[model samples]
Target: MSASDDYKRLQLALEAAGLDLWENDLVAGKVTHPATRTFQELGYTLEEVGDSLAFWMEILHPDDLPGVGAALEAYRDGRADNYRSEFRLRSKDGQWVWYANYGKVMSGTADVGMHRFIGVTFNIDDRKQREEELTRINQLLSAQNQQLDQMNGHLEKLSTTDPLTQLCNRRAINERLHRLVSTGQPPSALLFIDLDNFKKINDLYGHDVGDILLCQVAQRLQSCVDAGDLVARFGGDEFVLVIRETGNSASPFRTRIEYLCARILSILAQPYLVGDLMLSTYGSIGVVCFPDDGWTVDELTKRADIALYRAKHKGRNRYCFFQPNMETELQYQNNIETELRTALKTRQLELLYQIQVDRNLRPVGAEALLRWHHPVRGLLSPLAFLPDAIAGGLIHDIDELVLDTACATLGKWQQDPLLRDLTLAVNITARSFEHPAFADTVMRMLEKYRLPAGKLCLELTEHLKAQSFPDAAHIIDQLRAHGVRFALDDFGTGYSSLEALKHLKFDQIKLDAAFVADITDNTTSQAIATGVIAIASAMQIEILAECVERHEQLEHLMRRGVDRYQGYLFGKPLPQSAMEAAMHSTLGAQMA
Candidate 1:
């Protein structure tokens, strides 16, 4: 076929395939239109095209107008030859639609020099619209994911924070402090703050008012800090401030922090506005600089802690900077800690039994209290080594030792004709409840000693109930299934709400010594103890009052109807040999 016939056939084919081809004479600056139905499909009509190229240019979307004009100009000035560009065109309905309109020089002769431009306009508006929609949808999804991630992060923060005070909790603060020091950051400071006699307010008025007072204290603490400084809730009635960027001149920062501490104390000195109840409170603070105080977070906290001890020692409502002598004391504490670890390894620990008496002053069972009869120090109470052991991560070792000893001691006693009926009670730490091997460990101890599971009673302190319930409940279920009973020790001390008490399946509630000590003189204590007794009776859980020192205290506690009384009044804690002798005498007396 001839070239013109071939072109004609191709145009016919293009028309059949739903495409339109057209030409413009750049030299003449005139435009020509080729008939096609695709323009109608895109909301455009043939009657809309004007006779000049200027007419089509007028319909370009404003944003696309400049570039299209530039391209055409480039072609006309011979700066560009072939042209392919995308521009939005106003459809017949007057709405702008993007189009891919490309062209090539077709009719231009070399002699006439490239004046004719031919091109096809394809309706790609649907594809472009779908692509734009997809882009927009992707952006929206990305933003939603980012927001979700941020919300999750906020939830995590909330989990580790005290909601009312908006401060990091003891757990969070300790973790962050450990991380900061472990990272080997050179400069930092730890300031410990404790609200003085906060309980007196709670006792005089109510916890609601006390809560309001604490919130005010938190606000004051926040106000005292600069941006980016961290203030955390070290625990009940205590808070901590970590100064990360104190600019190397820690003294000035320390002074400012001390001033803040003084300000906090002063704020509490004023009457607290609690629902028309005017109340006054006080606070104590201790400050310690990093490296100067100690290298590790624990060391720094320990230094600040000793300073806090001194503040409380000198009297409440004061502030104390850690001094050289304080470091000396810390060194002594360190030496004690080292000695404690060695003592644990050498099995120098011992258990003392404190007799438990019923309302009739009859001895029933004895509590297994841990005592460290140090090689050189003679005898030391659990308080002496327990805290240091917990701090040094040796609590598990100590607890295991206590558990094994108690089991062995009780197991031997169970074989005795006289002491066989005695129940052995052991306290469970928070770590012990969360320990994955707790049930297994108890079972193994029981098996090793050939003791009945029912004879072994595990005492979990009130603080364990304050932890998350799912795991605590699971531990309870597992241990209870092994015929082991549970006791809530120090029952009135922590999170003592009915909600907390009801969640744990405690077989008994050990009244804290504080309540027992006050039972004789304090009416409030009497009422509280009565209420506790009533609750235990209703729950069918036994009640045991601790620290029954005086005969009057024992009489009052018995009258209040406590199931058992434990204290010096019965007998001070005795060594194993003493306990065995006392047991034999009691058996002989009972037989008589």
Candidate 2:
């Protein structure tokens, strides 16, 4: 075949493969392309064939120009055997298209520096676009995976930590205990701590302040522990500490544990400054040693809990070690709780009325005191089963029974003119009073008994005075609007302040028996009593002296401007029959 026919066939083949062929003559400073028509179709023109490098540089993307120029120069200088570069060039239609260029020196002498190059320029826009898309998708997936990993880590942390105090939670602590027991390398002691009167703090300051106090408590606990020990919040106002001993001796280990417990108690007992209020609280700690108390987490936790209960029962704000006998006492207490639950259903519960008299010894009111006549055990006072009732979540039931019985008695008393004017004072538990429906329930009971609101007085302990129940003032106001009166019972014996008394409206304040017990001789007691009376008088609240058994005590209280009195000096608590008989006799008239 002739040379013209072979060149035509080669041009047709290159066109069919979507390749544009070009040749550059370096010494001549000229460039030539075989497919002029193809170049026009791709939005380019080679009208100025000479100075091709300058023309290509003009068409190239500014960011890609330097890289392409460097690649060409290296190949020309024999530093690179072949030239290959990918670059963006602006097409005639104002769009940037990716192109891959391949070239080699067809004729060159390295020393003389004469060179002619031939290469193929291929349109790689589609492949390059796909590569860019894939890169973007990979980056996005990587970011999403990282975010998911972060979220999972946060969830794991949340599961193991107490959100309020940021301390290890119960589950985390239990798991740590299991791990430690499995290793069995070191002797460890577990201390169970329960804050004393924590509920009272929650009630008086509300949960917001309560949460702040809990965080402070957690910080104090952490400060008391060593680097190897762990402090975990075991829920509510309870915390558990895991202390590992370095030595093998049991005696020194126990001594160290006791020291830690004492230190913790001292630190936690210090007052906490929550917002504007300075509050005081204490902790009861129960200690148990591994191998000595139990081998497993459940057993040790149970024993520690029992010891904690014992600490609380033994005047609180103290620490106790686990003793085998405590389990028996715990079981007995549990049995008492079981029996107390049935006391009301079996009609074993009764109310004894304690008479309250005015300054003239006139009967003005009576306090309904609860009594339990156990089937096996004889009659028991509130102190005997009240704690059990509270722990068993049955105090509300007892409180309701007292309210119902008192209202029923008042309903019958309405028939007698002498007793009609006599007010009935019923003691209310803090839990019952804090119930959302307490006010409504009390009003309903009064209506059911046809008892006028003025005929009833709700006696609340001084503990309730410190609680920050948002609706407390509202509830009190609502009841007072219906003529119901309230009195602060056991007045000088609780954590109450003048600020609380100002906000909590009370019709009267009762002097606790302790304050009145030796008022005549004890100047401090007399002064306290005097101060209370003066405060009550200034607040327009009546003062009632309780446990006034001696004439000197009575005279002292009378001299201090006490409005009413209740104690054994006048009469002890009486049964329903005795109370009715006394009311019908001259004794009731004299008391009235």
Candidate 3:
């Protein structure tokens, strides 16, 4: 086909398709198009639209010209693949309408007359109007919700928002921690910040000044963390930071935490002028990581508290990561005592019995041991808190509970044939043993349960003071009269004296665990075990070995005439329900 015929067919197709085809002679500054469709749609005449590129510029919105010019420049300089502009253009009626223009700049060659910009245009006013309307509706909804919050956010604000610094409170942090952990996106590090010398500031300057200083410190703490990271006021002079994102390895992640804590210390060390006096204070930060230091909120907070104490003790204005050994020191005894009291009050105390067995490893009886189910620390044995309990004057109370619980279990066992004959031993504190009514309490328990003969034994520990010796004989005599057995516990560890004391009638001598542990290896342990077994044999008293864990140790002790054995080789300590279940299983096996 001829060129003119092909061009006419192309123009006809474009016009039918609602596209306005246009071209510009760049060097000559002239405009041409196959049709005036775009101009007619926007209420402009062909004559008014004019033949010059300058006319198009005159009608374009001033705000859009700069963008159009940049697009044109980029295309003309070969920096862009094509020239495309979305802009508003004024119509003959003086109303602005949206239009999209697309074109390609081609240099003049033999096929064309001059350098040309060829393109198409489409009026997009309706689509633009719909987008603007949707945006307006969203903004209106957001504004209305904000207004509602301002008007009716009473209890919600009181629970989550802090009144003093306008930051989050500890309660909010706890809730957020729960949500985050539930969603499997818990924070990586919890930075617990405590201001140094804050109490002195409160004392030297008044509490009013202290309050203002705290508010200023809260602001600085917010500045130290990221936008999504949580910053909360954990109480007076104490702030907490929850870091939302850190790498997931222990070593590199801890490095980042160390760097972040250092940066916070550096930033907060700056002096702040509150009212008239310039206040200078720095922070000590304790850091704990998720899945490293702990996973739960209670555990993390407990670990962070320990870390913070260490930081302050080592000297102020420093940061410390949580370490396992820190909680083992005497520094935490007071805290343990306080929380242990709460544990007892809240019924967090539990008792587990390690099944004691005869020579054939048959379950005979069990030892009732106390375990503390701390809310933050999980299940803990006696060594973890007994020293503090003793110093805090709580051991006596603890013993009373243990004694009562053991007796109750014994009473429950009387209903089942398999469990009825199983003797249960409970440790008795020196304080409880010395009480004048101690014998009376034991007598009542013996009468209440009608416990089987030799089924309830009171194991006397080495904690008895010299003052308790005077009354020990009388207490022992009364309890023995009621068929309650007495065992001298830890026989070789310095309290081997019921024999030497000459007044007490003890039924059993439990070989101390220290000797049983190394009976096969250590000569001294062998000698002690042999001596204990020999004495008990001559006296016709039953000799039981404690902590007889290894098979070798058990075999050796049995050879040496040890009458009974208790330790992990038989079974671990079990709760009451578990103990009953185990007894039932054993009874079923024996019957089969």
Query: lDDT tens string, model 2, 108-225?
Result: 6522444567777766576567987546534654675522333234346667899899899998989989998788857899999999888888987899999999999999999998
Model 1 scores a C-alpha lDDT of 0.75
Q: What TM-score does model 1 achieve against the real structure?
A: 0.49
C-alpha lDDT values of all predictions: 0.75, 0.82, 0.80
**lDDT tens readout by residue for model 3, 1-592:** 9999999998876654445788888778888552388778778788887888777888899999999888777666676666766789888889999877777756563124446778877665754689875465346536754222221233355567777898999999999777766677844788899998788789889998998988888888888777788999988888999887655456676677788899999988999888999988889999998867876789889999889978987778999998998887745677777887888788888899888878776788899999998887788998888767976778877887888889999988888888888988999877678766788888877777677667799998766665456578778777777778988888878853654335566788888888988899999988878877887888888888988788999999988988899988877899999877886787668778
RMSD of each: 18.9, 20.4, 25.0
On lDDT, the stronger of 1 and 3 is 3
Clashes of 3: 0
TM-score of 2: 0.60
What are the runs in model 1 whose C-alpha is more than 4 Å off?
1-330, 360-362
Local lDDT at 23 for model 3: 86
Deviation from truth (RMSD, Å), model 3 = 25.0
Residue-by-residue lDDT tens digits, candidate 1, 316-403: 7998988978767667767888898888878778888988777766666788988887888888887777766765677787888889
- Screening candidate 2 with a backbone cut-off below 3 angstroms (N, C-alpha, C), the clashing residue pairs are 203-467, 203-468, 204-466, 204-467, 204-468, 362-591, 362-592, 363-591, 363-592
